[model samples]
Target: MSLIEARQADPKRLIAGATGEWEIIIGMEVHAQISSRSKLFSGAATDFGAEPNDNVSLIDAAMPGMLPAINAECVRQAVRTGLGLRAKINLTSVFDRKNYFYPDLPQGYQISQFRQPVVGEGKILVSVGPDNKGRFEEVEIGIERLHLEQDAGKSLHDQHPTMSFVDLNRAGVALMEIVSRPDLRSSEEAKAYLTKLRMIVRYLGTCDGNMDEGSMRADVNVSVRRVGEPFGTRCEIKNVNSIRFVGQAIDYEARRHIAILEDGGTIAQETRLFDAAKGETRSMRSKEEAHDYRYFPDPDLLPLKFDQEFVDKLAADLPELPDEKKKRFIEALGLSAYDASILVSEKAVADYFEALVAAQPDVEKDGKAAANWVINDLLGALNRSALPIEKSPIKPEQLSEIIRLIKTGVISGKIAKDVFEIIWQEGGDPQKIVAQRGLEQVTDNAAIEKAVENIMRANPDKVEQAKTKPGLAGWFVGQVMKATGDKVNPQTVNIVIKQKLNLED
Candidate 1:
């Protein structure tokens, strides 16, 4: 179902806000590391998991005479991401110094975008649903700006007993800081926004979208006010890595703000830290403004501009996005909205599904049935094994064959499950495996009649019970299948059992 159908089904329940008379306003500032070979302004390697300081360059460490130079690939990637988000790309933008103090920040200032960003005035659409049945509500989240920035070094505190260490491996790395307008109204919306952002960046290939490795992070801005009232004082929750934690931080911070206001206390404007263990936000520092950063144009680097032709070419090469693919799946492939939604949720899964569908046979094939098997049986097994679709031992063609076998009644459901297990582990032609193992269902009338006769002779009392109580016929069918090792097709067993017992259809 679409979000519209869901809302119409239960308008009051799903739309109800926990704040009662208050509205929870949320915006997120996401910092995604640019996927490139080198840092923004330095020649340092942008590889992760390297030795301390191995990826650092003289410019990254603020050497006296080192000069900054832009990475063209990083710039192109940032622009690509902006275009993917439907943001307007600025023809020109400047780099500024964000002055700050930290042990790992040897430069004492960070190169960042201020006043003018590379992208502006865009929107992202977010939705949520079950495997496929979940409804997608189109929440138009406004993008304020997307700027290019350089990340600071990492301070490692757990390395030694007393002295801490700094890892400059990540220092000077390129980052795209995408800021959003305060349009979200609840924790669910916050989650939806983050998820959609992750998908977009992943699709754009601007970032790897690996939250666990800190390739992406979000600074959640949350505030609460009485319904229809002007926005309240917002607090910034910094560096929330996971989508689930982002939603939790928003919920916790909004409630904290509301409690403070209800108790006649003013909500403080500050930066806070989310403790995943406590599930709450705690004060970090007073929120800094642009003046605190001492904003000024960088003397080492000049203003950046792009060739219009190059950008147009890049846009032309853009791949199919999640929304577009979902729509086409429904319209062209005749897939249900829910099914399409599931296939498009992740790029790899969608690719896998499409590859199988592309090779689908025209004769005696059920496209929707094939989709159901892929979605439920195949995906369920993959999840249970803690593997991705790419890692599944069962190839698309193999799974497609299994679906065909079940459709042709060449095997019973129980027998098909066994065949799937074999294919999942042994990795062979599914039909050959079924043949070698004698796994095909015995659907012939004579075979089923023999099994039914043997079952009735052994259970004469149960046969009498089934004749009197029609529902008890199913019990006789189960006995016959058990006696025949379940190779007998279940439907055929049911037919022969009913015939033998003189039970009406």
Candidate 2:
């Protein structure tokens, strides 16, 4: 069963029109840099950081007679990503020239796909919101097209005090421009869609999906119309770099459109810029049509065709996607839906979780405890440091060792946290740390009884109070555990406390 179906159903319907029960329409254009060694039409390096114009080639600079040659590896990666998304791959696809004049465009026109795209018509299932008793809401968003294109160079606007510089390191790089249909209605839906898309692309290894590095960016299109009325004029919010900003842009634009209609004004179609600092979208330029760019097929490149066997080969080698891995976590590993979803959201995180479980002695029996420890303890540490799983100081084996210590009563939960901090910062074997620090749990009956006896003798007034009010026994128990530096098992303390105070057996 689908995640939403397996759990209780939520309100899937959109907000009744904001303006007299109006409906909101939304779409997204995501540009993800292709993972390749070189530029699309040139042998120049596709590295992100280099001196200005260091990676530019003769063709990339748009020399008068320089000819363009297609990169086969780029095409293969694009097709691989398309197949991973369960998209329709067009056996025959063509490239067209989109004419636009800008300083960043070394060439007067950009080579892109217009009439025929590489892939079309796919869907992705995205989980929204925080974990609730191991449950979350899942929504299926539609993919309209995934096309191949060349990225323009960067224009450094604020590098110096006076004139701006241009960087061609990113020029002519391969990009997979994935466009989504206007099936989204709310900002939350938009955020979830972008997040899930990033996860899928990262797992496929087609793109790094680093928004901070500008390797991935999104353009949000929003419009609002009265209930049962035709679609309203939409505005495109361009080049939003982060997922949080995408939600803010949509919300701001939607409310702006609604207020305009309410004031008896017309909503004009245009392109706008998202001012992240102010959390608003301001108009950039009037909307343009396809004829405005004067698009035409590039004569330098011939029509491209792919063999059925080739597409099938890439499909066979496709890694397990987020949705597939999530299902396996729930069905095979017996993890809750929420835990499975969090673990599978990133490739590294999921791999780390699997490694930890495999290193345990009783994985099948104690998998739930292992999952909780890794998710709550290790992940919490990595998050505090602002580091990814790959950069964590604690390895999977070390984490498993700590969990085993707790399981066998060699250490209590409170002491384990302290040991974890030592291991995390000082870099020593957990066994050695436990041995040297003498942080072992006091599970022996004689040792625990001696400590509890001192507490009962010193606090007779409290002991007398416990006979009548059993809850008061908790105070003496805390004193004893604190005296032992939290090395005593909490369950054992409760049993000894009841026995000493003459409460329940």
Q: After superposition, how far is residue 65 of candidate 1 from its true place, in Å?
A: 1.6
Alpha-carbon lDDT, every model: 0.83, 0.85
Q: List the residue pairs that clash in candidate 2.
A: 17-21, 17-22
Q: For each candidate, give its TM-score against the true structure.
A: 0.90, 0.93
Error of 2 at 18 (Å): 7.7
The most accurate candidate by TM-score is 2
TM-score attained by model 1: 0.90
lDDT (Cα, tens digit) per residue for candidate 1, span 303-395? 998778877998899998998988898887789878887788788888888877765687745657767878998899989999989998988
Q: What TM-score does candidate 2 get on C-alpha atoms? A: 0.93
The superposed Cα distance between candidate 2 and the true structure at residue 127, in angstroms, equals: 0.8
